[model samples]
Target: MRELITKYKPVIKFIVLFLGAYLLLSVAYGGYLKVSSHYGYTPDFITDLVANQSSWLINAAGYKAQVIPHDAKPQMKLIVDGNYLANIIEGCNAMSIIVLFIAFVIAFAQKLKKTVLFILGGSLLIYIVNIVRIAILAIALYKYPEHQSILHSVVFPGIIYGMVFLLWMLWIKMIKKSAT
Candidate 1:
């Protein structure tokens, strides 16, 4: 056992460090979620905000858009040009994506200041992209409702996850260049 451990010391060290960071940061994020919920920042709050912003953006693009709450749960109907496009839900808000991004960044952390700054910038970028994605998706669904499955399941998910992947790659490159 000692001999095997010695042979894979660096790999073992990385595993331990990455797992530790993931656990710690995830716990912290869970705590934040609890506090945010206590202050009324539930999934509804996030999805509603996304829906409103998406409506504004769609309107800015020369379409009359509005967000109206559904009679059911935490969802908002996206109305474009007075046509019901789709309903925005909590899963569409992208908080879970941001959480995943934070976890990966923490696992491969660099200097304290750089890592902190990177997380802030990355989170903001993710948030912005998500809003844009939602707006564009609403427009697409309005125009091409037949493509709903392809758009939501393939295109939109690809865009958000692609952006996150790019950000992670850039972070890795930056830290490597800095010898971190």
Candidate 2:
């Protein structure tokens, strides 16, 4: 038993630490969801604000817009009309933190500096990408509603996973550079 324990100590330590962190984060997120749901506050807030301030976003993009709630859906819905196109936008507007968390964990595992600046920069980029993704998805839904399921289930996940892969690749490159 002692020999077996010694042989797997490092692996056991890694698993314990990873599981501990994962559990902590999961609990924290669950609390956040509970509070948000209880207060009726969520990404829906962003959708509401966007719908209410439709002109700012649309006019800035040089598009005429009209946003109205769709009775059938439990989310914010919008209709935008531009110079030559029209679109329907519906869904939550909050960035998915799961992807960001995964990225952070990957970086941490690679021993990247946990400096505030580094975290902030990475978080900002992730948030920006999420916004772009939501907007693009809205446009895609409007233009090709028939393919919504494929885009949502496959393409969107692929994009986020691709970002994760790129981040991992960057970590590998950094590791190689440091070793020299």
Candidate 3:
């Protein structure tokens, strides 16, 4: 048992740290959602921000776009060119992806300054990409409503997660280079 533990010590450490960070951040985010709801934020501030930013990007691309709070749920209704495109939910905010990214980075963390900076920069990048993804998705959905399933379920998610995977690979390379 001791020999096995020693052999897998790094793996065990990574798993523990990753899970801990994920849980802590998730709980904090949940608290924020609860507080935001109590304070009368219908779709929560982050989701609202993402929705509005996505709308702005869409409009900037020469499409008429707007986001409004959904009357039936805690989501924002995204409208493009006077057509109801989609609902921007809390899950669409990218905070969850940022939380997962942070947790993974923490597990393989190196220098304190580098780790903190990477986390901040990576989170911002993910948020920005997510907003752009939403805007592009809205446009795509507006243009080809028949392909909604494929666009939303596969292509857009692949784009976001693919970027995240690249970020993780880059972080690992940085860690390896610093260690050498």
Q: Model 1: which ten-residue window has the lowest total lDDT?
A: 35-44
Segments of candidate 1 deviating more than 4 angstroms: 3-43
Clashing pairs in 1: none
Candidates 1 and 2 compared: the better one by lDDT is 1
Best by lDDT: 3
Task: Please identify model 2 stretches exceeding 4 Å from their true place.
Answer: 42-75, 82-112, 115-118
Q: Where in model 3 is the C-alpha error above 4 Å?
A: none
- Displacement of the residue 105 alpha carbon in candidate 1, Å: 0.8
Q: TM-score-based ranking, best first? A: 3, 1, 2
What's each prediction's TM-score? Answer: 0.85, 0.64, 0.99
Clashing pairs in 3: none
Deviation from native of the Cα of residue 156 in model 1, angstroms = 0.9
Residue lDDT tens for model 1, 32-101: 6567657654345777788888899999998999988887555788899989888887788887788788
Report lDDT (Cα) of residue 153, candidate 1.
96
lDDT of 2 at 136: 61
